[model samples]
Target: MDFFTAQEQARRQTGRLVVLLVLAVLALIAVTTLVVAVVLYMAGIGGAHSQPQPTLQGMMALLSWELLASVAVGVVALVGLGGLFKRRQLRRGGKAVAEALGGREINLNTRDSDERRILNVVEEMAIASGTPVPSVYVLEEEGINAFAAGYQPGDAVIGMTRGAIRQLSRDELQGVVAHEFSHILHGDMRLNIRLVSLLHGILLIGLAGGMLLRSLRFRRMGGNKRDNSAALVMGLGAALMLIGYAGTFFGNLMKSAVSRQREYLADAAAVQYTRNPQGIGGALVKIGANAKGSALAAPQTAEFSHLLFSQGIKQGFSRFMATHPPLKTRIQRVMPGWDGQFVALKPAPGVTVEPDQSPQSTAGAGGRASVRDNVRASLENAGAPHAGSMATVLSAASVQMAIGAMGQPDQRHVAQAQTVLSALPAALKTAAHEPYTARALIYAMLLSENDAQRQHQLAVLENIALPDVFTELHTLMADVARLDVQLRLPLIELTLPALTSLTIEQAQHFRLCMERLIHSDGHVSLFEWTLYQLLLSHLSEHHGGAENLTLQACERECQRLLSVLAAAGLEQGLESVQERASEMAHALHAAQQVLPFELAAVEDADDMQALSLAVERLRRLKPLQKSLLLQSMARCIEHDGRIRPAEAELFRAIADMLGCPVPPLLGGGTEEQAVLAE
Candidate 1:
């Protein structure tokens, strides 16, 4: 259940994939060389004015080292280039994959009840897990399947079939979404995308051969010379076609080898996440009973077969080649000791299952002592440095709860997320779903409290923003100004899908206006910086593969990040500069004890620019290393035993940038109490 461990496993899986690709390529080259050698020997013997090479030694002579080497080179070049081409095409991330399969993004403002329900479910899960809300797409098919696709969490999107929204009840839909989210959390999407690209390379030879065969229809072959030439081309094309398909057959085996086990893991994860086995178990049963089942009619389904929730295409000839386990087996695994009966697909009202009253379910639904309160009380008891006392602010249980929530949020977190969503003002929530008002909502969030600064920001936006957007900002300013501070981050999370829907021109204009507004104040506050970084990171196109950096190599970046967290944690009303410096030293010391290396002295000029650069650099750290860094950060921020609202926000932002999702830490307190405690 450790997030970083899952990510490391995925990295290892990539290495295995590469080895398989290499083997497949070598096999293709060998087959292709043999085919070429036979063609050459036959042509030599059939020549009209040349001596015939009909002997075994003469045929061996045609299969020279040079000829074999040339074929090898040609095969390698074709496969390598084909894979690179496909990988580049998918560089736009999951959206490109979804769109290529004919998925239309569900509009955030859609009034359809099913679309709205799915969006709400997605938003709750995202907020609970501390990741950005992913855009949702619906394929125009009636198969009960879903997929989560992206290179990373920032660009991830969830795709569902039409049948899934219509056929599955609310709990069943939640289960399906949870399964896809598991793929997003465990790094399966990137691996799936790479598989697609590699398979395309293996199949390229077949594509070329088919094209060659089809071109013969336009050519005139009346002359003897032309006839021979046509025959040679036809033979070579046929050989390549056969060889390429054979390579693809092995590639499919590789896909099954890699993906089949992961599907089981995802199903188990879905059950664990929702604390209700019947949710996902029922979904599988429906898929088994339905006529369309999980099969897709799209022609590109073969390429993305391994990415779906179930077998996306019909398995022919060999069950071993299926990317998913059989339906009955998967259901039994999730729901053991049950009679094996497929749920009949009836056109009745949606079933409403009562909530489970088991102890585990009750605890997940907030029946036990709150972890957030425990951490807060511990911090409160530790006291500030200036108060002439301090104690251990993080208890074992509190630390476990905090770290355990990352990429593996339990039902409690989901329940709390639902609470947060319900608390939002209706108008503000509605505004967050449309591109125009979403932009305005963000603009309003950045408006300054001081009269002069607020006027300046407003003027800047008025001159630069689109007229309708500017007007919307004016209308939403009152509600945004009154928004609870604890809800700000969640609200920002909600805006991502809508913001991402903006046209290229509109997005460019929005970014420009935001920059102007932030700089118009002459300085960026912590909240402003966090908002800008979070939005830009998700909104920009993500390209390139992951970079591998050890903690040792990123020591300087690590130091800067820790230093910023330390500075952010200092209480504002310290009586003297010496007191402030003393608190900072104590925070650093706390972090140093947890980290493996010695802490470096941080300069007083730890501005937002320096912190931003440091975060960007540290993002490349290996997954486990990132886990350690996050722990050290938590230790540093908790040194004084209390977390201010701003400090908690900064910590969450840092974790999000590093690809870690920390559940909300300010839960279970009244809005006034939470604000006043800071």
Candidate 2:
């Protein structure tokens, strides 16, 4: 689907919501008006001595109008509140996406060129597609699945499950990635996130109404039991609230319908992005045949299923509430002849499996015929010097992974992160700080993993060399917390790694810690849990068997944690951690604190100051800090309703002071983003 189509769909959905709310308001007003009319009509009893009073009738008419007007205002207010809350959610989600993806540069420490190649491919595609390269994440899941998430192209992220890397062929993986990219490029992601926020807001109304009704019922039952008039009012309030809830149900159905339609478009867009339906189509066929398929047992799956490559979640019991179209319809769309009957596709006879040497996709870039040449020779090249690089970024995932291209990342993503960090450009390799780059990297890395696996990975690292890698490991965790509006689950998991060294019993203790934490937390973060579980699988080499009761124990522990957090007093917050972390004053921490910031001589940095005055102004710490802020500032020029171009410049200067090199902006990707065309 194109941008225009997405807009039309959003507009229609939004309009439908408004219309329904309006009707609800009208119904409420009419009901109230009728009830009042009947009451007033009875009050003016017809008796032998009864006299007509025009003034009484006129007063009642005026009261009825006032009541209708008030209800109209209330309904509009509800809708406005939804939009306001939704807008805030969109802002926060967008920021999290940017922080997770934007600051990542290629980490030079990657064991093999596989990740470097992944970075290069992402870069090439971004250049070709005329957009900035998106952030890439590797999932630790052994199952093949990928997803794209973010509100817009500037902030979009592409994450793949570990299973995808282990199982899917290069072309097949590319197909999955391309489908997600299409969702990002075509604006499906923004709509999906909006749906989540808006639904939460709208649902609050029904919840409030229910609470109000319950309160009235309790109030009337107290000492006012025999007050017939109050009882009548209480009953009327309950009926009004019940009527309000009916509207909420309709609104929910509409929102779900909107979500389902976008899923279809994303599927279509994925095919368009890859230009190879069979790559994704074939993968789907395999998933359908596999018993596990795309089903994720992780509790977080339900929260983000709409953003997945396939249906990994469900919302409510009804079919309309489902986020994605049925599997049969999806398969038929991609592969027209695919029968619902599962027919296992057989590899051709006598096919010899060989090392992958040739490029499967990359749209000819780094190949015999690249996307750059294919498009540059056409009339589409608009003199953008960096176009080639960006295109590689987009087409990167579509490339087939050769045996040489695949040096599998450790299932423990924290360990893999240490490896990823080592591969970074020298100037960008900053040690982990709470609000800095490590947090971002962890988000990108974990975006690729599910919750249970994430927990397991953290646990494994804790048992392995966790205390040794505090800066990177812990900061990575902070990033997860920052992105989530909730507490850092990994922090709770981080409590168990022995500072001295691992003992046989220490490892067992770590396993128990995971079990206790999970049982306490109740439901684990689906993505985080997936990562931890994967780590457990990888740790099978060091530990005992892969599955026994470790995961089960963790699940039990999570329930306990959730109940504890609910109780509130037992939970620790950041202040305690900050005080504890004071002892972690290593070389990196010292360097961050003591280094004298370096500044470049700006020819015209200050217009208000004379040359001497300008020099004085440049020496100020605020100016330098502001300059440092610019380097990491997102593409968003306006944040929190304030313009910050000057601040952006300052951020750039400060980052340079800290010796962090900034990347050149890659603008306007062709073929995908029309915004880039401008």
lDDT of 2 by residue, 130-219 (tens): 232355666544444666666544445566654554455555655666566556545566666665555554555555556656776555
Report the C-alpha lDDT of model 1 over 577-647, residue by residue, as the tens digit: 79987888898888887677887558843478987888888888888988888888888887766666556
TM-score of each: 0.89, 0.44
Off by over 4 Å in 2: 1-63, 94-128, 135-147, 158-170, 213-224, 228-241, 290-308, 312-321, 343-678
TM-score of model number 2: 0.44
Report, for every candidate in turn, its global Cα lDDT versus the true structure: 0.78, 0.41
What lDDT score is found at residue 66 in candidate 1?
Answer: 81
- For every candidate, C-alpha RMSD to the true structure in Å: 6.3, 19.7
| Model 1 TM-score, 2 decimals | 0.89
Residue-level lDDT for 655 in candidate 2: 26
